[model samples]
Structure formats: structure tokens, C-alpha cells
Target: MKKKITLLFISFFILASCSNDEDSSIIPVAPVAPTAIHAVLNEGSVDITWTGVEGAGITYNVYRNAVKINKAPLTEAKFTDVLKNTGSFVYTVTANLDGAESTKGVVSEKVILELPKTKTMQSIDIYYDTKYEYAYTYDTSNITKLVSLTIKETNTDLTYKKVTVTNTVVKYTYAGNLITKMSYYSVDDIPRSSVENVYNAQKKMIGRIVKRSDGSINYTVTYKYNEDGTITETNDARDSGVGIYTFGKGNLVKYSITTPMREDEYLAVSNYVFDTKNEPTLNILGFNFFVNNSKNNEISSSTVITLNGELSSTESSKSDNTYNENGYVLTTMKTLKVSSGETLQTRQTVITYY
Candidate 1:
């Protein structure tokens, strides 16, 4: 019984000794101070700079109006927002260390927006060439009513051809800002081997359609924004198609079509490759209906055609053309080469009535 008592006393003594030593070694840690924070405003952005907290292994939490806007790692010391619209904004920068956040440095600034004048009518010349010019008189005071668009083309025979395209369109306004209206028209005698010269506007073409003639009906286009403030494109076709685009850090990364269209079997799919400066490296296979509009009946494999920001290597086709000093192509040319390696060229002489 004495041995058992002695053993229990020794164990108790050892336990008490360990407990006291642990209590003695406990040391309190001090809180880190927020340091060296500054904010600057540049042309269209806000720049924030700060120093790292000493021995805190801290990250950053940027808040705008109690809502966390961004989170950065311990290594980062700067952040900038390029989209600062005209409004008063509150900012808070908090320090995070070991899953704990420190008190924030708060700042507030107001963005100023200076917009130019709207709702004004002016006369501008829509020039076809040095010789071909027309005066466009726009009166936005009543944008829904008919605004006159009268165009005159100068011919080589020193004569002016006056062609008029008039329509009554309704215009919407945001206070005084003018909203665009959808327009539709067709052109005739575009020189296609096939007699079908009509094209549907809702087909989503990648290039601009210059009116050579007039069409039957006008198609509509509506623009809207995504939840993330990105643009969404939806067409007004009988079978409507939609697409959303995503941009890389600063460059256009990819665009995807969604809803009611197959990715593989769709009418068109384009992949644009770019260099470091976002200039196009190559346009793999962009399609255009302008090939049918050329006066040439046969297309040769060796023919090369260059348009604004685009190039195509197709077969040489004959064309009949009319040209003017103002750079308006009134007519096309005839095709002479059926096989590759022959060059066929034509010119159009334009005459404008001013």
C-alpha cells in the first residue's frame, strides 16, 4: 500500500510540474499595423498602392460599399480599376493573415462624367469620291419623321445620277441621346450566275453589307448586357440565334454561339488568331456573298482579292467594271482566266451630280 501511494504521488508531481512549465512559456502576440496606403486617380482608372504588413503574411481585401470587390495574394501591392463611372464610391482595404483580417484603410472619391452635347442636327457630306458627293441633312428634332438622305453619283461622262432611299424610322432617346434604328433594303443586278439575288439579313454575316440595290423587308437587331456586363448578340431571324463573347486579360479570347444552333453544323464558325499586339495573324475561312456580286462568271484558283482588312485567294473571275476618281466601283469586270496564273483586271469610271 505504501509503494502504491508513493508511485501515485510521483506521477502527480510530474504532471503538476509539466502544467506549470507550459503556463510559464505562454507569450502574447502583438497585432500588425496597417501601413503606407495611398490612392491616386488617373484618366479613366483608380490606382491603389500599399506596403506589406511586417511579419503578417497578409493578403488584401478591397471593398466598395461593404461589398468585397477583389482579393489579392500576399505578394501583390497594387490594384487598378479602369471602369470608374461618374459616381461617389467608398473603398476599404483590409489585411488578411493566417485566415485573419486586420482593420482596413478607408477612402472615398467621386468620379466626374462630362458628356458632349446631344440632340443636335447638322449637315454632313457623304462622299463617294473626289467627284461624287451628296449632302445629308439630319434633323434629330423629329428623328421618327423622315430625315432626308439624297445621294448623287458622278459618272465619267460628266453627269450626275441621283438615287434616293427614303424610310420613316422611329428613334428612341435616353433623355437626349439618340438610339439607332434597324434598316433593311435589297440591291438588283448584282451579277450572280444563279437568279436568286435575295439574301436574309438575320443570317449573321461577319462583314458589312453595302447597299448596291434594295431588298424586300427590314430585319431587326437588339443589343443587351450580360450579368457580368458583357455583350450578348441575338438575331431577329425566324429562327433566332444567340452568342456570348469572352475576352482574355485584355484581348478577345473566344466567342461562342448558344441555343438552337449546333457548334459543328452551324452556318459559320470563325477562329481569329492574333499576335502580341492583337493584330490578326490569319483569318482561316471567313465567308462572304460578295463573290457572287462580282461580274466574273468563272473563278480561278490563282486569283487574289483584297478588301478592307481582309484578303481572299480565290479563282479569277471575269467582270465588267465602271470606276470614277472618287473610288466608287460602278460596274464589275469580265473573267478571262479559267485556270490559275492569269491576271484579269477591270476599272469603273464614276460620274457624280453635286
Candidate 2:
């Protein structure tokens, strides 16, 4: 019995010793650095993605410009950062495991943010034996709202007497940065018209209602967007019209409008061949409903507008534009081909940015 008891005690002691030795040898290891860090530049943001570490219970810390940006360690391997300005930004990510942080993996990128101008003034002067000058002012106190627009027109000859010296004012109201209401007033401070715009959650204009000065609904237009981003607009009083828009490298490439009344079933079409900068032609609204949601008023290289599907060179209107160093339209020469002859028109537009 004593031998047996002693053997049992020895066995128990050996087992306990082995258990303690195994416990003391075990130590927590630091996490490895994140791999395959990538930064994708967007219009006003940057998307960063990386391969996650293999270790369990791993978390990540993201740093921008050498400063930590995330409020807490993130478990996901991807993050999106909204940028305020345009410039170069450096990003680094570090992995953490059990309170131990690994060395950071770095990536650098230059971000060019295309934010809309806050306050803009554009003056266009057209000359063709007669002179017509138009001035437009846009106020964007609220970033998402276009506060007001003032349009002034002057003509040197009364033969082109549609333009007046008095300023026409248009006030805009917004919902979530999308124009919802537009009120127009004549120079005499008389209400001329009011337009109400309705948009879906995607910020695409879905419907528009126009009201004349007498507060009666003059017309209503509804729009539908295809999955490919093309649009079809239908008026309550007329047949539907289709607008086909094409994009290349994230820039508007072409936009064609077709109406039922046209003989060839095409009202107007514009093909945009952009420079390296990918800027489009300037317009009064500073916004292209066909291309994007934002308001960008820049000049284009060339624009051709045809009416009633008339492909004849003698009936189309064409304009060629030149830009200044700041990308503003310096000069525009427009030729209107009439049935009788050709009429040459020149225009100079000056834009001020703030």
C-alpha cells in the first residue's frame, strides 16, 4: 500500500509541474502590419482598403497626414475618409492585437476635390453687328443651396430687342442641396413665374411643375431614369422625349435629345471632346441635369445645336470656344447658318470665382 501511495503522489506532482511550465511559456504576440494598402481617390473623398491581419482579435488604426483620424480602432479593413480640401494626403494603417500595435503600413495619394464655387459672377458679351451683354450672379451661401441668381441684359441695338436693361431675379430654395423651388421676378419686382422641382432620394429630378404669374399650373414634366443613367422626360400636354447620355472616364461624353415632332426624331445632340481637364461647356444655370447634380460653369471646346433634325450644314448653329489660363471662356465665335446666308457672332465671357 505505501509503494502504491508513493507512486500516485509522484505522478500527480509531475502532472502539475508540466501544466505550470506550459502556462509560463505561452506569451501573446503582436499583430503583423496590414498588407496591400490601397487608396482610391473620389470627387470629394478617398476610399482606403487593406488586407486584414491573420491573427485573431485584430483591430486597425488609420492615420491621415501622420495624425490619427478614426475615433476608435476599427475591426473592418476598409474605411472612407471625407476630405475638406484638395491636395496631397498620406495614409498609414497599423494593426493591433491584445493592446500591442504593429508597425504602420503607409500609402500616399494626391487628392483633387471638385467642389462647387460658393459665389460666382459670369458676364457674357455677344457681338454680331449688334451687341448683347448678359451678366449672371450666383450666390451659394449654404453649400447645398443656390440662394439667388440675378440676370441682367443689355443690347446695343433694338433690332435684338428681347434683352432689357432691368435685372431679372430668380430666388431658389433647396432641400438637401437640391433645388426645390425657383421663383422668378421681373425687373419691376413683379412675379413672373414659379417652378417647383421634386427629387427622389438619389437626388435626381423626378418632376417639375411650372406656374405662371396668375398662380395656375402652366405645365408639368415628369422624368424617368434608366439603369444606364439615360433619362426620358414627358410632359402632360405633349409626347415624351428621350435623352441619351454617355460618359467616358467619369466625364460626360455625349448627350442627345430626341423629340417626336422632329422629322428625323432628333431635336439636338451634343458630343463633348474634352481637353485633359475634362471640362464641359459653360451655361447660364451652371448645372447639367443630364450629366451630374453639381453646378459647374466652365467652357467647352465646341458645341453644335440643331433644330428639327436638320443635318444640313446651312441650318445648324455652331460655336467654338477658347479658354484662359484659369479655364474660363476667353472668347466664343458662333456661326448661325440661315437659309439666306451665314451670320457670324462673337462672344466674350468673363467669370469670377470666390
Query: Per-prediction TM-score, please?
Result: 0.27, 0.56
Predict model 2's lDDT versus the native: 0.61
Report how far off residue 81 is in candidate 2 (Å). 3.1
Q: What is the lDDT of residue 95 in candidate 1?
A: 72
- Residue-level lDDT tens digits of model 1 in 1-354: 999999999999999999999988875443353556665644335676666665645567766656776754544766775533323355566776666677776454433222111111112123222222333223444222223323333333213544343322221112122212223221232321111222234432222222212543334434444578444666565565666554444443445443444333232222222223211111001112221121111112233332332443334433343433322333333333423545433322222211
lDDT per residue (tens digit) for residues 243-353 in model 2: 665666555666666667645554666655444442322322324442343222223423345555556333334556665444544454555444455543444443333
- Please name the candidate that would achieve the greatest lDDT relative to the true structure: 2
Give, for candidate 1, the lowest lDDT window spanning 10 residues: 278-287
lDDT to native, each model: 0.39, 0.61
RMSD to the hidden true structure, all candidates: 19.3, 8.4
